[model samples]
Target: MKIENIRPGDIEAESFRIIGELLGDRKLDPRYEHIIKRCIHTSADFDYADSLYFSEGAEERIARGIREGAVIVTDTKMAQAGINKTRIGKYGGQVLCYIGDSDVAEEAKSRGLTRSYVSMEKASRLGRPVIFAIGNAPTALMAICDLAEAGQLDPVAVIGVPVGFVNVEASKERLIRSGIPCIVARGRKGGSNIAACIVNAIQYSL
Candidate 1:
């Protein structure tokens, strides 16, 4: 992918294509295809409108899951904070949270909130594939895939929604490494907004 030409919206399209390819041989219900199409169109709709090119409140939704003890993993403080706020706003308390930071992990543990540091190794051991956002944490994402390959983490799915232009391929690489079929945004166009949209689609699909 051309880093210079990459945009967040482009990644959203790529993710849809990848998911379609992954489901090629599966007994995918029409509903599943509808969900993907709706999501893709929704994203494109926003992009075409020239207003609100990203999904709002994604961090909050992720945080809600984390608060519910969903073994979440993310690579950005903004995402982490957004997730936390979502949990707090919806659940009115701290969620069983873990973060990529050592200090945050320790803090969560100190509070006895079922906290642990997020690492690929740890995420893999959690017995579930996690939705990974694109960020600067390629190493961590790769580690998560390694663990999945080693059977440490049996992730249900993977996603490549890298925000901004840096390392868009990292999320895709993680999805490939995890070997858990997933939906991802393509190229350097992915960002936090696109990643969150994909997650929303997954949640709605389920």
Candidate 2:
């Protein structure tokens, strides 16, 4: 086995170069190139280049919202912890995960609903521009759709990439049809890490 000696700082650049080579002749929109590349870098899976879906003008909307200090809500604490808080804070934005909140848990238990659902409901009342980053629960996506339908919440953008078999595809489909700005992974192949990477990619592009 031969190990190529590459500098630590240049490893990521080299990896991206290889990825670009592997994707030769495949044209990706210049606007979303960073996001697609970042996802592939995180998972070592080129499938993201094909699976990721972006709503029309979603990137511009999300970038503007972030610049204006939108609050980011995630379905899982892992996603919340993975985001780059320092960069978000520079834009006066903050990341929140309500799945672990005691009130959210209690409400979900009392209503026979998942904690993710209750968390979305709770986030809706924040009275500020919000960006949802859901990576672990389809129920969370459903709740957001419901809230939007009811005219109770208007999220700036949604990142729907929950990884699961149970209603995962259905939830993403619902989000796509909701007429909301969104970025989605169109199958059961996402995670908190991927969700965070997406956010980081957007931030890095800014």
Candidate 3:
């Protein structure tokens, strides 16, 4: 038998070095490289380096909004829990998830919509700038996009990364075609944790 020990910081530092090596000569857009890097770090998937897409100036706008007290509205509680709340709070912003709220549930039932869709509808009412982070439920992404297109809601930015076989790719494709500011993961390979990582990456940078 053999035993070895290393400092946690040292381990993480080495891990990042390995991640960089795994990346090789691959190049990201540079503007949103840090955000993608954090996603890859969280998932240990180098493919994210290319899969993640950012609308022009999306990172800068979202970062500035966060600094200026913009609110974060996530589709699921998992995403709310995963984000860096303390950092956002420093700028008087908070993370919200209405999935478990009674009103949201009731509204979803009454409207024949998913809870995530109703959550976005509720979030659209917030007078403050809202950054919708949807890492689950393609219906939610569709709802937000509909609102934005109708000029019913004006979100500061959208982070769309819903994961599933159904409607996931379609919802993301809709966002890409949209003129709104967004950070998205193309295809059907994203989740709440990935959404949180993108938000935290921006928050930590600031």
For all the candidates, what are their Cα RMSDs to the real structure?
11.8, 1.0, 1.6
- List candidate 2 segments past 4 Å from native: none
TM-scores of all models?
0.47, 0.97, 0.95
* Candidate with the greatest TM-score versus the true structure: 2
Q: Which is the winner by lDDT between candidate 2 and candidate 3?
A: 2
49-113: candidate 1 lDDT, tens digit per residue: 12112223333444345445454455555444434235333433331223555755775567553
**In candidate 3, what residue range of length 10 has the lowest lDDT sum?**
1-10
- Checking candidate 2 for backbone clashes, the offending pairs are none
Rank ordering of all candidates by TM-score, starting from the highest: 2, 3, 1
- Candidate 2, poorest ten consecutive residues by summed lDDT: 59-68
- The lDDT leader among the candidates is 2
Cα lDDT tens digits for candidate 3, 64-166: 9999999999999899999988979989999998899999999889989998888888888888899988899899899998998889888889999999999
Between candidates 1 and 2, name the one with more favorable lDDT.
Answer: 2
What lDDT does the true structure give each of the candidates? 0.46, 0.93, 0.89
Name the lDDT value of residue 2 in candidate 1. 55
Candidate 2 residues 120-170, lDDT tens each? 999999999999999999999999999999999999999999999999999
